[model samples]
Target: MSTSSSSFPSSASSPPSSSSSSPSSVWLVAYMKLKFFTRIRRFLRSKAPHKRNRAASDHHAAEKPRIIDAVVDDDEEEKKDTDKSMVLQKSVKRLHFGTWEEKEMAAEQIQRLARDDVSAKKLIAELGVIPVLVSMVAADESGRRRAAIKALLELANGTYTNKALIVDAGLYTKLPKNIEEIDESTRQEFAELISSLCSLANTQSCPSSYEIISFLISILESKKSSIETKEVSLGALYKLSIVLENAGALISNGVVQTLLMLSLEKQLSEKALAILGHLVVTLMGKKAMEENQMVPERLIEIFTWEEKSKCQELSVYILMILAHQSSTQRAKMARAGIVPVLVKVSLLGSPLAQKRATKLLQWFKDERQAKMGPHSGPQTGRISIGSPCNPREAEEGKKMMKNLVKQSLYKNLEMITQRAASPSSSNLKSFAISTSSKSLPY
Candidate 1:
């Protein structure tokens, strides 16, 4: 077998060659395959550390963005916190600034802040600006005082808690003393502030209510006050009069007399009459109105005038309320000559006025009938004295009927006599006097 393998050729004896023709070719192929595998192994070995380093670098590159983002997020959060802290620090710093102008600006800022409920609460609770504002109000400088008032007014306009803060700060008591020193506009501002405070039902319990009532009354009664001051004061009083406790305070402050005096001024008459209507709601108010004859008297005159439609309407409305107080008030109104005016209003006034006037007229009629006892009616003008009623009441009703009849007759006679003495009679007397004077001159 060794001799045969050597003779034929070891490669040929090993296998039949369909692709390779020689041993060298086969050897070259084997050598190329080995070299390829060796180079592949070398390439793999050489690339291993690089691949690991590249993977690590890629991982670090991805993580770097996340780390930077975390840092950036932290930085932004710090910036936002810093901004909020800066705003708060600036507000506080400006609030206590040394310059009056700066302080006034701060106050104005506070005023603007007080307009919002959350900010107003912050101003009062967190910052405690109310006492600062009150000090500014009592400041010697008018500018500061005015600024402070505006701030306080805004503060009062906020939530009920803010209003309580203002009231507790003694703003109500301090404002009145500053009235004379301030301008008319400032005084009006004060009146508006009081009105705003009094508008809240919760503020009714505050002593400021009565104090404000008295302050406004004083303004109304002061002859030296401006018309604007008086007007705003009347407005404030009107607001305060709606509160039951304030009504007593108003009456005690002699607001009735002040309103009576104010009613005479044509510019102020309508508002004064409007406030008077509110005042007459309470018992003390009604009693005060009754005592002041000018109140009913002026109301009756306004109702009769018929020129000022609003004033006339308000006057009649007030008279209607007063007339309903009691039989005595009805009698007083009748004595004031409001009955005939009411009857005319019922006939010729506006729809609303007519309706109110008609009711009032009916009220008067019913009161008259009530006074005249069960037997009296519209047809029976006189009270029946011999009826089975209270003897004293019958006697009183009889006297009242007699006085009314006498007054009616006297008014009728005066009208007839005026009608008899006409323009023709006056012309004839003037001609005679002129002729006599001419003769004396010649």
Candidate 2:
């Protein structure tokens, strides 16, 4: 068996037979070698399919880029969400427990974050960062206060809940007691924050504290205040005036007088007039405005600005509100020569201005009718025996009284007629200079 096995292996499994001198054997060996090399080359060139790749066995094929991108996007979203949460936690911690400088740094970061993400504003407020920032607003260090105010401003932008939190924090009391003393940039930042928080006037129950309104009024009255700062302060006052309850505070602080002064400035007159309009709806505001020296005259001056239609409309609206139901205000307005301006505005103002001017004109007309009832009487010469006095003297008295009563009205009507034909009638100037305070009954 061993000998047969060895002989079989040598014949079948060993290298090609050494008896290759024969031509047939040599040809067979050459053909076998060529076929073996061909098989080896084919194995090297082709790819083998794995079970996982059986569905797309084509060479170099990969999954679509969109599919990979979608997976990457989901992973990134999760990572971003985690990062946001971590940042929020860190900010809250720093705001609560860190030193003043660290807290200011955190506030700056929160401002940047809040400016970018609306949802983050509410979340950060919920984390109670607002009160901390508000406290920091009163810091002795200007840098720290400014950083806190900037953060509060960003948080208050367009987010009602955040503003509510800020107000609840009593941000008004946090306002610098002496606004004029602060640097311009810091003061402007404070004014801007107040303005932003004041926008909740209509929505929030307690729109702004009295401190806030007074602070804003002080800023407005401050000679040191820049135009931009005053403008922002005016905006805050405007918001506070929206609520009738706030009118008393505004008036008590003499905001009416401040607004009147501002109304004289062409650049600031529009906002000043707008706030006055808001305040004019209340009785206290009306009285304050009526008593103001600049009331109708300042507003009357605003009427000449044909280029300032908005100012005209606001000025007229404020006048109408002031003139409504208050004969004293009407008397004042009449003395201020508001008639000729209203006449011009009624005819040649903006659509809104024209409407308001016409409505105001109607009020004047009604007032006239109320004071001077129908003058027409029986023309008949029939005189009762019971009547006393002479005919010639009576006739003279009748004509003289008629002339006196109709004189003021005639003068106004003449001006209106002349001004209607020509916007800048000389008669208006004459009437304004000549109209008697006692001749017209408001």
Q: Which candidate comes out best when scored by lDDT?
A: 2
Model 2 CA lDDT for position 365: 75
lDDT of 2 by residue, 1-442 (tens): 1221122112223234444478777666556544533432333222222322332343454666645565566556545554555465456656865677789889988998899888667667866688899999889999998999999999999987788888888887777788767998998998888788778887754554678878888888888888999988888887787777788878888888888898888888889988887777666877787777777898899999999999998898778667766788888889889988888887788766776676677778778866866555535465667788688858866876686668667557645644444333222111111122112122
Clashes of 2: 0
Q: For model 1, how does the per-residue alpha-carbon lDDT over 1-442 read when each residue is reduced to its tens digit? A: 1221122212222222323568777666455444433433343233222233334445556567665665566556555434433343344445543366777887776665556435434433345667778777767777788888888788776467667677778776675553455667777777777767766643544653566766777666665678887777776666666556667777777778878877878889999988776666566776788778686777777776566777876777666656554677777777778767776775666555665666676666656556655533234344465656677766777776776675565455444333333232211111112221222110
The TM-score of predicted model 2 comes to 0.69
* Residue 142 in model 1: lDDT: 74
Worst 10 residues of 1 by lDDT: 427-436
Candidate 1 regions exceeding 4 Å error are 1-88, 97-102, 112-125, 202-209, 223-231, 265-270, 305-310, 325-332, 363-442
lDDT of each: 0.61, 0.73
